[model samples]
Target: MVGWLLAGSMLAGACTASSPEVERAAPSGASEATPATEASSQPAAQGSVGRILEHLEALDRIAQRNGGTRAVGSEGYDESVAYVSRHMRQLGYSVVSDRFDFDYFEQLSPTRVERLKPRKAYVDGRDVRAMVYSGAGRVSAPVEPVGFDLRSNDHTGAGCSSDDFSDLPTGSIALLRPGPCYYRDQVVNAQEAGAAAVILAFPEFTRATGVLRPTLLSGAGIEIPALAATDGTGVELARSRTRLRITARTRYSPLRGVSLIAERREARAGDVLMVGGHLDSVMDGPGINDNGSGIATILEMARAVAAKEPDAPVRFAFWGGEEIGLLGSTAYVESLSSQQTTSIEAYLNFDMVASPNFVRYVYEDEIAPAGSDEITDLFTRYFNRQDIEFKTIDLGGRSDHGAFIEQGIPVGGLFTGAEMLKSRRQRKDYGGRAGASMDGCYHRPCDDIDNINQKVLREMVGAIRHALFALLTR
Candidate 1:
């Protein structure tokens, strides 16, 4: 087992704590740092926080030049791929680009929900929402409440069986509540009943007054339109003699997303240390903090590693289509050969590492492979040596790491926080607003360059750098 050596503080900040012992095994065929590797480590200034910020500024400009977002299926994301590929080639690393197909969706115009009988227009995106895979069209038809007790919140057998839709009219929209069965089943039932459309009524207890949660189902074959309605609107449609009109102008089409892979020139052996971050932003924002932070960190580290080329292979992957799902990473893993999968010793993922209101979070990987503990320990020891506080979060397949974990690869990562509200104790530990979300602008239009916390960004860079150095030197 190789052990981390502690001695002094880093360029970013102070270190006061006593060193703690942690054991990590050397990778297969790993060697001690050569003269070139030693020289490369000394030029750590190449990967400084300032350089990372420059890259971030460039990404922001790229987004601005495009459609103000680096989301998949947008020109901004294509330019981002070009940018990363160009930089890696200039750094003398051989770059590879892989493209994959994905379903691209966009809400083209404001959705409309109206009660024809009462002649009222409810708010769009709030009181009503068009489910993801809903067919794009307008339907003005009678509202036929189906399934168990439409007036009650306790929907016992709502839309679970075909019998529920037997009496439903063909030219009407079926109103049903979510119940015991999968939503897909309920939707299928409604479609088989020859209903013109389907409306899912929210239960009274749904806290967000008018906000409709987006659905994940792709609703592949069922062509009829589907919509979600708030409890108040639902109640009005159910009890009162009502006819409703729903319109959703949405575009669903195919788009190709690219993931960039760069390998250091000197690396020859298949045993690899892989690091990655998703490069795509959500459609609503620039995604500077959600992922730009992580991509910047990895790019800078790749620059540093290139400067001090090592014999062991280091793969730097910038994935696409992560905002929609882990599509890019999943495709990459699926494309890999069995030999290639086994060749990867470990994967370190960095996502949302620089939230505006931040916490130092490391992926715990409680049920992970043996190497996962070592990966977590590396970050832990580095933070300890720097006198920084950090917390461990369960790796519950929330990011690209899920793809690697699915292949039984030891995966670990870092995330500051997302939409989850921080606790009082976290506030005391991180010196941020306890009651508010760690990142207030998560997945919103406001997540521009200004959303990054430079202090945390620098610290995160420092910690990641330390961990990479340890990995290479081990």
Candidate 2:
């Protein structure tokens, strides 16, 4: 899954609870149809829980052998691609290892922030740290606080607008707070206003002890350094009105990564049905539940359905660089000709499908393309038949689906949950701890195989298989 905050405006701020009454209704103006019976909806025997866990275990071992990460531009990611490709070939599917280039970022040294006038240096990784994609630079200048409302209860919306930096002097470090907008917008605004650097302050109400770590998403045309600060450090800098020195050393290199595309050797012609999930993990951890669950589920589905012939061609994609941005899927979509693009009838994405405190979630149809409601209904019908309750989530350009949606392709998918806290009502429906994050190990080093909820995984896999057959036959 993409980093919730790092992906910037591309992501919906957070997953919000859907109104149960509204979600359960059939799509507007569509006639209701009879639900499929068990005989018709049965999945392949190979699509078992044991088989999916075996795939996860293989991926876990791959990460363990390759420095505990499967992030893009890493050896672990390459191995992951090889593993999937080999499996697809064994299953008699034509597999393609599509390669693309991306800008890879690396921080070379410890970032430095100092109060020059007072001769005090703040601790690195505690009081200050460089934001991801920050340009390499060192500057000593006066610190100017821009657009701050220290007295107001709202701590957001400080440096979001260009007007906030209208009076900022050239070569000065602009001090600001996060949100009410993207971190990218604030940094870009400061850079355009001639500030030598930027310091983004953490919100006062946050209980986090360390400095904020945000991403500028991309470093194009950004020549100045950007840093994140603790709330205390920001307030002190604003009040003292002193000179400061900021230093950050970083590099962006051109690197290649691969996305694996697989399809049956004798796929049918006409409109194609696509199913996919991101394959790369964050540099932080193994990312077992963040995406390993999705990958394993889809791989098992591919194995189960390999022998069956569908009405339309089914393409399975394992996307790369989704953690940085939707690089692989975006490239794939952009590379397609108009005719090729139109041939793709719909896309189904599965990401983070087994949160420890899981909730059954279907992608909200309202925000997706025209034909997406049908896809949403397919998953909902399966869950409803199983007597399972589900919620709807609006994921705006957050995952691989965003690329397909850009070209007016209809898309729908399932998600257990990620990063957001489960409410008391959710606890009642799903039977998990209220106020705890749905996936407690999300994006952390603890996101290993043990982080997954096996019960949730099994249920989600059943729903996925049901929807897969329904779409193929229709």
lDDT of 1 by residue, 358-459 (tens): 877877754566678888877776565455678776645557887888888887777787665667767887899986767777766677889888878877
Q: What is the C-alpha lDDT of each candidate?
A: 0.72, 0.79
TM values, all candidates: 0.78, 0.87
Tell me the lDDT of model 1 at 68. Answer: 81
lDDT of 2: 0.79
Q: TM-score of the candidate numbered 2?
A: 0.87
After superposition, the stretches of candidate 2 with alpha carbons farther than 4 Å from their true spots are 6-47, 110-129, 139-143, 153-155, 158-160, 179-182, 202-214, 228-246, 310-312
Task: Report clashes for each candidate as comma-separated counts.
Answer: 0, 0
Give per-residue CA lDDT, model 2, range 336-414, as digits (tens). 9999999998999999988999988888745578999888878887776666678777776578898998999999999
Candidate 1 whole-model C-alpha lDDT, 0 to 1? 0.72
TM-score, model 1 to reference: 0.78
